[model samples]
Target chain A: MDRFRLPAGVRDILPDECARFDAVQARLRERFVAAGFRFVRPAGLEYFDTFAGADSPVAPSAMFKMTDRDGNLIVLRPDMTLACARIAASKLGAESAKLCYFSDVYDFSAAGNSDREIAQAGVEVFGEAGAEADAAVIGFAVDCLEAAGLSAFIVDIGHVGFYKGILEESGLSPAAAEEVRACINAKDAVGTELALRKNGASQRAQRALLALPSLFGDAQVLSEAEKLTDSPAALASLLHLKQVYALLSKAGKEKRVSFDLGTVKSLAYYSGAVFTGLAEGVGAPVLSGGRYDGLCARFGKDLPAAGFAIGMQRVLRALERDKEVRQ
Target chain B: MIRVALAKGRLASSCADLFIRCGIRADILKEETRKLVLETSDGAFKFFFVKPSDVPTYVEYGIADIGVVGKDTLLEAGADLYELLDLGFERCKLCVAGFAGVRPDPARPLRVATKYVHTARRLYASRGEDAEIIKLNGSIELAPLTGLSDVIFDIVQSGGTLRANGLSVLEEVFDISARLIANKVSLKTKAAQILPLLAKMRGELAAKDEV
Candidate 1:
């Protein structure tokens, strides 16, 4: 008889790995509780519409879906943010809420670092739209990471609104905006400039779009961003980042904060302040979150929201690599 | 210090030449030796000479800060790394070929064999052709000759090997060249050092019409 094979992208956690994972999760729960983020364990399966938020990047076709007995389509939670939004809107309506979730998100995307089923510990701040909220979650992320025995990490912060401002002022169609965003996300400056020109974007918009891929580095790059555009929204986006950075400094975590003006988040729902946490040795980001004020509106309630999820496997991988070096 | 994984053989030599031109002490890289790794006399950089295909793997895993490998290997492996620059050496073209004058049956799914499974699969998909890709480690050209596949998707240089194998080029897919790729983290934390090197290389490459 042949040994049973697990499905592709599936891994049976061995005893030692499971123990280590449990310990990490315990520590995460402790820190999250201390930070006043009430825990909410959302269902493992959600409606297909939940994961597909406004302008969501989680393509429905790439999701694992099945029809329930009533013929309503169900899907594994490809993301927890939408589920959090649903809960905040339905049960905890019209009130400020700070919710945290520890769940496994199923990502059926094409082959990459994305695990088919990912173990994630995430936090979502509801009813707060200020830059301080962005700073608080980021500081919490750093706190959890530090408590986990990881060091030499920086949180890369970006703003979708910065580019969105340019597109809005340019009056490009939604399709054209997507094309421009995709090209910029790929860091293909030439392609983006050509596309913008072909879409009849103004010279200012074209120049700013071209400058985006290189709009990365320390806080000083914020000043350099002034050259991108003079639109009030673009300027306001810069000020928003400045405010977040100032709050980060107030929290004394400014050294671990960097601005990536060109970085594009995978989800289109990020209304402001997108960020990813990158460690020194890890090639892929270990933590990713952003402010998505529009997601809750999909659940028929309008509330400002921002949250981020930490990849448990990535953290473990980095730790294991650290162990190998020490040994 | 910056560490570079230079793909062994011809690409390594070309990359070493470029590095030396950029004021980097990379002569230890071009010397005839069986050593797997070497460091420049200046001690500012370390060079690891790995198999041509393993360069990207090392860079992607952060074992080395940067790598010099052909675009074909980068595409096939699809390692997560920053493709920083194109060194413009070891020029070749990825082409599809089979026994001369043989017409591929359009009614059936084409049996394509090559070491570059991802590249070939993408090419077939782009052409809207269903293909059964057969992965081979060595002697990929024999698949078509031995009736194993209807076509072979392989890199062609000067058409010498295809002519010797009694095969003719069917379609030219695209060009391939060496690229300078960096570990994502290395690009961020070591930008102070790596960016200067990249800028210098770009400047030199622009100045020189020839390697």
Candidate 2:
């Protein structure tokens, strides 16, 4: 019966949509290349353990798994940009590298959930660290979104350490900490308070935890958040975000930028300045990226770096909607 | 223009009252003849009446620049829209309820009936309990009584329904009140109009607090 309709969440990106997808991909590639990022392509499949570290949010069940020739567990690459960084460090020995790619990632959960395969076109800069690199990546993301005709959007900025540092300092058990992280990520304030209370955290910690969701706004959120965190690392992260904001202000994209201490990255690999571009008419983020200093280390290279990825599917969705409205 | 999607129920009526307090006419809301879209006289705003669950989707997709929906809708949809203000209306609580004393046990895979599968899954997962989720469209409270589920995940405003049915809330999951959510794009593109409207609403809310 029509080949079972390609499963519920998986479908063919028809010629019409693919044409627009390719045009967007080409525009991003040209812009990234002109900005001096070398193009790189990673295998669409990798060993499961390669993404099992602290930086990956890929659940094992979410991956399309298979047995390798050597009987090792392998899975289709759920995200090419991260795998690209892994390859750049291990295969190319490029600790400090700038790479751009256009590829489809296979996520099994996409079937019956969102869609299994996603066409993602974006850039990754490895080895460049600090506020300068963060600004550059965010600036590039802004350029890509604007280029795709998403003129009305905001780039929300946050640092992974901002929340992680506080959670670590809460003296929670590993399991409890993970639960708390999930709660905070979901913007479930009541759940967070209950989790913290059940974990027997101090009253001060519980109060601070409950306030996490409301601690998001413009740049002032940084200073307000700094007062809540006792961890030095968390404070340093706040300072780093301030420096990045200054850089964006100099670049004149500061108005388009907002601060969110509660903004959590979808991927576990983001280490600093995690951000997502939001626009009207799209159900998800148009673009997302952050600094992943430890990701390169996973591929046998130690380097500080930051980068961002444009969600081709979501961008196309916004563009198509805009076109429909205009017509 | 700022677009607000109001749930077509008690929350919508309450929101209309708040809008009137904030200097919005809100008379268009009274002409309820299945008209989906309504525009204010000043032509600076538009409102869409939609199902509470669909309000988040509309706001998240930027179809309506903003939305006035209960926190329950936000939790269920899990849309990435920016929740800007707590309108403090339609207040309720999401809870787990079952036959009086048949509490949640983590060891066994409990079956839960709910209209909010995402929220239920997350609630159980957060508690380190894995429960088989059964998604139902309506009358969730009837599931446990009918033996279709071990427990029911639903919103409780006063716990009257549960108590009347010989059930009690085993655990309260979340405190939900109505909130103002903005589409990430509309918040920026229409900032000149949207921000002022938001400021007015905030001013009115603050005044209410003062009174």
Find the candidate with the highest lDDT and give its number: 1
True contacts kept of each: 0.33, 0.25
**Which stretches in model 1 have alpha-carbon errors above 4 Å?**
A1-8, A12-23, A52-54, A110-114, A167-183, A186-206, A230-232, A320-327, B41-43, B96-114, B127-153, B160-172, B209-211
Q: Which candidate leads the pack in TM-score?
A: 1
Candidate 2 lDDT over residue span B110-181, tens digit each: 999999899899888978977999999998888988888999999998988888888888888788898888
> What DockQ does each listed candidate score?
0.35, 0.28
Alpha-carbon deviation at B146 in model 1, angstroms: 7.1
Residue A209, model 2: lDDT of 70
| Full-model lDDT for every candidate | 0.83, 0.79
Local accuracy of candidate 1 as per-residue lDDT tens digits, A114-203: 569888999999999788888898888889887766766788889988888887788788888877887677554545776898899877
Error of 2 at B45 (Å): 2.8
Model 2 ranges with Cα > 4 A deviation: A53-55, A111-114, A172-180, A183-220, A223-230, A321-327, B73-75, B78-86, B92-153, B156-176, B182-211
